[model samples]
Target: MAKPKILVTRRWPAVVEKRLSKSYNATLNPTDVAMASNAIATAFAKYDAICPTISDKLPAELFPQSRSRVRILGNYGVGFSHIDLDAAKAAGIVVTNTPGVLSECTADLVITLMLMVARRTSEGERQVRAGRWTGWRPTHMMGAKVSGATFGVLGFGRIGRSAAKRAHHGFGMKVIYYDAFPIAPDLAAESAAQSRDSIEAVLHEADAVSLHMPGGAENFHLINAERLALMKPTGILVNTARGEIIDGQALADALRSRTIAGAGLDVYEDEPTIPAALLQTNAVLLPHLGSATRATREAMGMMVADNLDAFFAGENLPNRVA
Candidate 1:
């Protein structure tokens, strides 16, 4: 039997390449860069599968261009917001993601963001770097306290539960959550998190709000002007999830006006181009780097490779996205 062809959208872990080369003709993207929709449509034509990241855009038009032999798409990241799902479905393609493996890494980053914002890590670093720091004063760079506060988690999932474990158990925070559906009773009981009726309810009640919802039409601009207004003037909002879920400009304006205290954002609507207005604010700005640990990157690559291996071998995928 002829070996299948693989189109790797970006350079992945070396280990994944070695395994893929064994069973499939793995071809790396010509450049270490994001491919345009037309480029992706053309390049994807020669392969049976393509592994894409959040940066890559797989448009609906590309589906029909792919050869009939193309069977699966092995996504390197967890979310599929970048892909046109309806197009992939119509083309009879299977989409798989690396879900459970990166949960802890992302969750840890969420907590890290919350801590950095709450504890004034970024400001202190800036102060020191700018050589403006003298001796510590009693009221120097004071911020919010996490202990004994209510932590409102939005969208309970693997990452959300992981974050809940840290906030509730490690910091003695009371965890309240808002999800469309009830989580498994056993899991909810184990996490010790209570569910809220609505997102507004969570916002109004939580001392800090951490978002974990997926990015899509339903969730786009979830934390808008009105929703963010519900937050306590002293509360913080942290998002390690998708960027478009929250309106960046609105949040920036809110921060400037002190609507909510501050925000810690890892992702953004126009990535690599944060709003000019947000540049000089108290917001803790980080490039989209939630699951950027070396160990986590390796695990994500391996999981994608494993999915590709299973699909090509006619086995059930461990993490199918569509």
Candidate 2:
């Protein structure tokens, strides 16, 4: 039988690329640049399976109106909001994502962001590098204290709970969360987290808020100007979740006016295209490094490989999302 032909949209880790190449007739993007939409559309006709990462935007229009030769979309990341599930389903495509492997690393980045923003580490590093740092004084670069503060979580999924535990156990902070579907009491007790009735309740009380929710139309701009107003003036916000959850312009305005103390973001509403207003603010921004660790990235790729293997063998997909 002929080997299954597959197209990887972006370059994966070296180990993953080697493993994938061994199993299937894989075409890897050597440049590591994002594939253009037209190229992706062509992939549908050429490859038996298309492996896509978050950077690839597979909308309804991208799917062929006629039947596509592609059978499965083995997504490299946990979040599938980038892929239009409705369109994939209509076109008889199965979509699978890698979820469990990335939870700890992503949560670690959340804490890293929270601490960097609260302690003003990014600003301090810039000052030192720019040759502007004077000797330390009692009032030099005063910043918020993360230890023993109230940490609020917007979503209590795997990553959210992991962050809550880090705040509570690692830093001696209080953890409170609000999830659409509350977790079990025992699971909540692990972090000693209390469930709030609404997102507003969590925002109003937390000293620092971390977002771990999914992104879609329902959560688009969910944390807008009005909701931001509910947060304490001393509060800081961190988002490792989808960027659309918070309005970039509103967050920039809040930072400029000192409505909130600071923000640390790993993800943005639009990837690689942050609002010009946000760049001018004191916010600490990162280029979506939530699961960038070597181990995590490899694990995510292996998970995708597992799903693809199962798919080709006509076995149950390990992480089918659609």
Candidate 3:
């Protein structure tokens, strides 16, 4: 039998790429640039499977207007909101995403963001780097205290639960979470977390909040002006989840008006394009580094490889979403 042809939309880790190339007829994107709609459509007609990362946007239009030969999509990341599920289903394309592999690393990043914003480390670094730092004073760069504070977690899934554990056990924080579905009682007890009925209640009570919800039309702007108003004037916000989960303009306004203390954001509403207002604020912004660790990334790639292996070998796919 001929080797199944596959297209990797972006660059992946070296070891996984080598393994994938040896197993299948794999083509890697040399430039590591995000594939355009036409390029994705072209790949759909040419390849048996196309592997994509979160950076690649696979909307409904990218799917073939007619029938498609693409049998499956091996998504490198956990989030599938970037790909249009309905369109993939309509085109008879199976979609699988990598999950559980990056949980610890991503949870670590959430904590890192929480600390960076609450302690104003980014602002302090900027001052020192720009030669604006003078001798230490009694009233320099005073920021919020994270230890023993109320840590609100949105979405109590694997990543959220991991972050709750860190906040509760590591920082001595009280973890309160809001999820549309119920979390296991034992898991909540283990993390010392209390589940809230609504997002508003968590916002009203927390000294610091971290978001870990999915992104799509339903949650396009989950944190708008009214939601921001529910938070305390000194509350800190951290987001390592989907960018659309929070309203960037509202967050920027809240930071400028001191309605909220500070923000730590790893993703943005638009990739590589930040809101002008946020850039000028003291918000600690990162270039979508939530699951960028070498180990985690390789694991994610191997997860995709495993799914593809099952897909071509006529075995059950482990992480099929569509």
Best by lDDT: 2
Across residues 16-83, which tens digit of lDDT does each residue of candidate 3 receive? 99999999999998799887878888898899999998888999988997768899999999999999
Model 2's lDDT to the true fold? Answer: 0.94
lDDT of 1 at 150: 91
Tell me which of candidates 1 and 3 scores higher on lDDT: 3
Task: List candidate 1 stretches off by more than 4 Å.
Answer: 65-68
Global local distance difference test of model 3: 0.92
Give all TM-scores, in the order shown: 0.95, 0.99, 0.99
Clashing pairs in 1: none
lDDT of each: 0.86, 0.94, 0.92
lDDT of each residue in 128-151, candidate 1, tens digit only: 999999988999999999998998
Arranged by lDDT with the best first, the candidates are: 2, 3, 1
| Candidate 3: Cα lDDT at 136 | 94
Score candidate 2 by TM-score against the native: 0.99
Candidate 2 lDDT over residue span 86-171, tens digit each? 99988889999999899999999999999999999999999999999988899999998889999999999999999999999999
